[model samples]
Target: MNGTLIFDGGCGFCTRSRNLLTRLDRHGRVGTVPFQEDGVEERTGLRPDQLAASVWWLDADGGRCGGAEAVNSALSAALGTRLPLLVYRLPGMGRLQEAVYRWVAANRYRFPGVTPWCQQHPAGCRPA
Candidate 1:
């Protein structure tokens, strides 16, 4: 489970985010798993809706970080630097980031190219 990111496989946005992370993870520090895939729920204990609400990161130390915390960690790891990491650790920053994340999550269906099935049945939509 170390350094793994369990994401909503059904969401186009999540797929694109995963791809961007993969490209930035030159040291192979990050691995991605789609929540809709077989065995993912069993392994992560996260239901599909939970995963859709936010990104989740399992660190090498076995600690779990979610929402904006996960995003900050992933970005810092991908960049191989500590500045962005520091920003995330700053007081109030994490909370602010999480707030923005929630707003975006709530409106993801409005984004172009979001599948019609996802728009019609958000909870039921699985990765295509």
Candidate 2:
């Protein structure tokens, strides 16, 4: 596999993002797995708390990156371009991107799909 992305399955926003990633992955170079799945921790060598904290990308060469960096890596691979990765690595841009990602992740359940789903199925959704 070109790369593997691990994300929060219980998060609606994350799920929607994954769907978009799926569409962008025309060559199927990236694969996604919800962190909630069994064996994920063992496979990734990450603890449950760590997995739940951010989206993670595991590269083919045994490299791991999380949060906005993970997103950059996944997008770069899916679109078959280095633009996203390069942009993310720019001095201040990386910090800005990470801040935005954290903001979105913190308020994820306030979004459309998440709010409704969490309202109906509180136990199934992770806290925002």
| Candidate topping TM-score | 2
Query: Per the 3 Å backbone cut-off, how many clashing residue pairs does candidate 1 have?
Result: 0
- Tens-digit lDDT string for candidate 2 (4-36): 999887777887788789899999999988787
In Å, residue 94's CA in model 1 sits off its true spot by: 1.0
**Angstrom error at residue 98, model 1:** 0.6
Model 1 stretches with alpha carbons more than 4 Å out? 113-128
Q: Each prediction's Cα RMSD? A: 4.7, 4.0
Instruction: Go through the candidates in order and give the clash count of each.
Output: 0, 0
Q: What TM-score should be assigned to candidate 2?
A: 0.86
Native-structure RMSD, model 2: 4.0
My TM-score estimates for the predictions, one after another, are: 0.78, 0.86
lDDT of 1: 0.71
